[model samples]
Target: MAEDQLMTYAVGEQMNLMALLKNVTVRVAKNGKQYLDLTFEDRSGEITGKFWDASEADVERYQAGRVVRLTGKRETYQGSPQVKIVSLRLANADEPHEPGDFMIHAPMKTAEMEEELNQVIFEITNQVWNRIVRSLIAKHRDEFFSFPAAKRNHHAFEGGLAYHTLSILKLAHSVTSQYPNLNAPLLYAGAILHDLGKVTELSGPVSTQYTAQGNLIGHISLVDGEIVAACQELKLDVNSEDVVLLRHMVLAHHGLLEYGSPVRPRLLEAEVLHQLDELDASIMMMTNALDKTTPGNFGERLFAMDGRSFYRPSEGLTGKVDPEK
Candidate 1:
């Protein structure tokens, strides 16, 4: 397909295009035949695809992270957009693009995000919290900026980990201004450090998957452990009130005990961190879904949003808010 022809695909449109195989899985059908479940992504967005009756060679050839030329038709199943794969094969070596060329990334550039984050870090006034956050961030600087915040769900694109953190940090700033009694430094530290452990939890940006530690311990606990380890290494008292409060913010950001939090928010900063985290994640998920849906139609059912489908208002009120307005 020509570059000029590529655009946000519509349902039922037949297309022959090249796309990155973002994820692939093998599953057995009701007939006991194995098939490939696939997620394909281009510059625009992602859609599910299926290749039925797969052979071993087919599986080996179509692994995730490879770019492939596929003939398919856009489809809707269970209210979500997908593709009906007619044929598929690995892209030729001579093809113009690589897998990275098709990847979706954080809206802000890495350098811009880094500079903004450094400014936020400078505002963390508590010496103990400041030291721990700086030490950990410097240790995992590259991955912390590049890794996706999740394997799937909100901010699951390249550079999403840092992007999600910055979004929450922005929210924390606004919230603290409105409620001056809230500990601004504590909330800022929590927002920046809460998901940093995802760098260890997820493998990397391409073909992202949970590591064994991620599967067993999860990012919440993994980060809590890192905070304790940092305190020990930095020669700070691990049992100090400052350390405990910061750890609680990380441990309780998930808000509820049932939602993977070891404990619920016990401090004001921790509660605010949890709320900001939830707000940013929810908005990202909704924005992603709405982007995929045409105006006046409903988008896919979001599993993260309790399997709800949100409508895109025809009035096109989806642009960024102007603070001056």
Candidate 2:
């Protein structure tokens, strides 16, 4: 089979691209016309698409998560690229494009990140806590490496769960080193297991969406339940202080009840976990926005960040070595 052509549609270009159907929504316009609004993405990037006068059959056939062949005319909407769909169909089985071609992925290698996480866990001296953390991680290592941290929010890419966890672990380590009073084992345990339930919460890495369990239970409580189960399986006392504090960190890492944390952070390590998680997520969101911005311009409004826009300065500054000299 021949390789599918890359999706590189210019404005007004007629595109016949085979790509993954991302988020799909069917809505009625003001004129009472039903249409399909969708996102199409390959490894290159994503673009919005609309199929006007769409029928119910179309909605059922080209639902989100399916790979499809789209015929559309590229156009601009609100300064962003979009497609006016002419026709589309579910990709045939013989479709040459690999699934990996349609998904976004983390910058770092999964094995490298996993090794880093293993190192962090191996450093924990508290045997009970170390066993608990290591057990949970080992049980879900495959999904942990493949699942995104979220469906649409930050770290929503292949290998994102591990990437996000490892990034937080590094931040937590640096923080604990500076504040000698902070508990390194507790922080490391919290960092590794805080988002463990995300493995079950999300559908998969590509064209990610929340699972039924995710929608009903959520990652925080889901992971808390896992910790409790691990305690039982290991014949450890759930009521022990170490177990309680570790569970507390997972439950309270969101930092507030309104944000899905059942309890506000009460322990110092729990508080630090919440802060580090927030800090890492915020930086990822900001950096993602910055990447999209033209140098010297404000970024698109970030709904997740309270509709704030980030700035990317174009001004030249000194580096250790100047390239333009």
Those runs of model 1 whose alpha carbons end farther than 4 Å from true positions after fitting are 1-7, 316-325
TM-score of each: 0.94, 0.88
* Tens digits of lDDT, candidate 2, 229-248: 99999999999998998999
Q: What is the lDDT of candidate 2?
A: 0.84
Report the Cα RMSD per candidate.
Answer: 4.3, 3.8
Itemize residue pairs with steric clashes in candidate 1. none
RMSD of 2: 3.8
Task: List per-prediction Cα lDDT, in the order shown.
Answer: 0.89, 0.84
**Model 1: number of backbone collisions:** 0
Which lDDT tens digits does candidate 1 get at residues 298-317? 98898888999999988757
Candidate 2 wrong stretches, greater than 4 Å:
1-16, 71-81, 84-87, 92-95, 315-325
